[model samples]
Target: MPDLSLLDIVNLCDNCRVHQPDPVPSPYDSERLVPFYLSESPDSPVIGLLRPVIVEQLKLENQRSRDSGQRELWALNVDESNFVSRRNRPSGPSVSFRDWLDTHTKRTVAMKELCERWRDTLLFEDVCGPKKWREELYPVYADPFGVHDHPNTAAPGQATNFVFEMERSACALFGVVTYGVHMTIYDEVEVDGEKTLRVWVPTRALSKPTFPGMLDNTVAGGIGSGMSVFETLVKECMEEASIPEHVVRKYTRASGAVSYFYRTSKGWLQPEVEYVYELAIPAGVDPQLFEPRPSDGEVESFELLTHTETIRKMRQGLFKPNCALVLLNLYIRLGYVTPDDEPDYMKILTRLHGTFDFERW
Candidate 1:
């Protein structure tokens, strides 16, 4: 196969951006999705985007619950064309999605039960096939652009801007913006008296559900509900790479984040944000101290590759789509990919941070 250009690598992650006219044209747009609202109020925030199939399923579920004299979980406002949490009480006003989940005593339990029930259905099998079921819950943030603060707060929902938690497997089904942390760990070494960086990259375990046997970042994991970015980073470092907390805390530096709207091959929407980090080990430090070993079955093995080799593999499509994006961001930050050499430098930079603003949808 021919080598992919740097822009091609970026396009792989942010492929949705390459498709024009925003909302997508009809006939060919069977995957056009609708915004999911927190409440029936016009001002309520859009917490997710829902594909037509999922929306139809939800509508049917709502009808069935209402017909059986059970509480309807969702309210479909025809006038506004959005889905919201149905008012549980007849006398009281409708509650926001966050309040409904938090006060109903179920919290995230209701959603979990729903997913479990759907696990046996054809719709579930189609949207999130067997290989994609992560059995993990990912938080849905109300304010997508807001800061995720109060990481250590004792209160259940006070720590972050999350409204509710859904199965990670079903996130793409709901078209929610999922958050994760990716750390590129590398060592600066002197080669013939010149400083060069060698990065540690991992191959995903073949038994893994998604992107099995694909190249991945040194350490990466989703930020589960109630977990802070740093907390998730430290945990992933140890769990995925066997790198202890102290080494991570000392060497890892926050290197901003990459946001992009991606559509899976199955046509499911995935608007995601990956918090990027860099772990730089100085030239004189013992290499063995910072080296990564696969402690979790999620990774097959770890390999240290030079900068050139890393870029070559990336261009060859050896890396997972988003992982390649993280590597591209790393190269840009390290001064290896710049405006002078890369003609699409500005375009690449903008698309790297392509926030899926609701208005654009």
Candidate 2:
């Protein structure tokens, strides 16, 4: 098969932008998706986009919890509608999933309890089952906009303006946007009097729960609940690639970020933003010192591939989906892929930096 184009790679990550009409139209069926709100007020900001199945499950769980004399973690407000048309059509419930948790207990504790209960029960077994559960907690911001600017120095429950923290595994169930950091470590060398670029790429451990045995960025990991972007980058570098803190601080450059809404083959929503960074080993440095070795079991091994070979592997779909996007962004930034060569230059650039401004959706 021919190598995939840059546009094809972009489409792989930003796959869920198109809106599909509900086939069995109901009163709630319209252009907009069910928005998960931070509060009960109609004016509250939407923190997530809930799928139909997830919406139904949340409503059922809310009713069940209330019937059992337990505090309902979520409140369904059917009175207010966010639908485009108000022609006597009963709109879908505006779910205030975090408000009750925020009021009753510390959001951090409440969300943990809620997720633990769901994990124990049969609810969302496909995604939130014990086997699939990732014990790591991810923060949910009340206002996710401009959150990257804030330092990750806050405690578990005290991220800047964050509403709550949820289990990383269960985040897809709520369709919330998640944040992570991705870094590309590369080097430039002169071969046969010609300049050449080579990148350090790691193969994911086969034991990994997701995307096992696929190629990945040199250092990449999700920003845990209380960790900042750079902090996560540094931690993942050492943990995954055995790169030390001083090496990371000296070589890493904070590149721009990429955002995309992805739907898994299992039909789970993952709206994600990855803060991108690049670590370039300066010329004349001993390659052995900056070389990546698998420190943690997360990476099976590391390989340094030439620019042509790296793009070939990417085009062949060897890398994890989002990791490929990070590399694509790298190629563009380093001038390997440019407007003069790639036909869909503008389109590729636009999709890579998706606004993620859901109001227009």
| Candidate maximizing TM-score | 2
Q: Which tens-of-lDDT digit does each residue in 1-361 have in candidate 1?
A: 5799888888777766322433323332544456676765546666777766777777788788889997777755433433333323112122234334443226367777677777756457855555567777788766887866433454765545656677888888777789999999887667899867789999999998778899999999998877889999999999999998999998889999999887776677789999999989866778788889999799989999988898899889898999999988898888878899999999889888987755544
User: Cα deviation of 209 in candidate 2 (Å)?
Assistant: 0.5
Candidate 2: what lDDT? 0.77
Q: Estimate each model's TM-score.
A: 0.87, 0.88
Q: List ranges where model 2 is wrong by over 4 Å.
A: 18-32, 78-93, 98-100, 103-105, 148-159
lDDT of each residue in 1-361, candidate 2, tens digit only: 5688767777767776525532222333342456677776555667787777777777787788889998776766544544322223235556775455544136567668767888898577778888879889888876666564322455655546666678999898777889999998898878899888899999999998899999999989998877788989989988999888999999889989989877676667788999999989887777777899998799999999988888888789888989888888888888988999989999888888875546532
Global lDDT of each model? 0.76, 0.77
* Best model per lDDT: 2
Write down the lDDT that model 1 would get.
Answer: 0.76
Task: Kindly report which residue stretches of model 1 are placed more than 4 angstroms away from their true locations once superposed.
Answer: 17-30, 78-107, 126-131, 149-160, 190-195
Per-model clash counts, in order, read 0, 0
Quote the positional error of residue 327 for candidate 2 in Å. 0.7
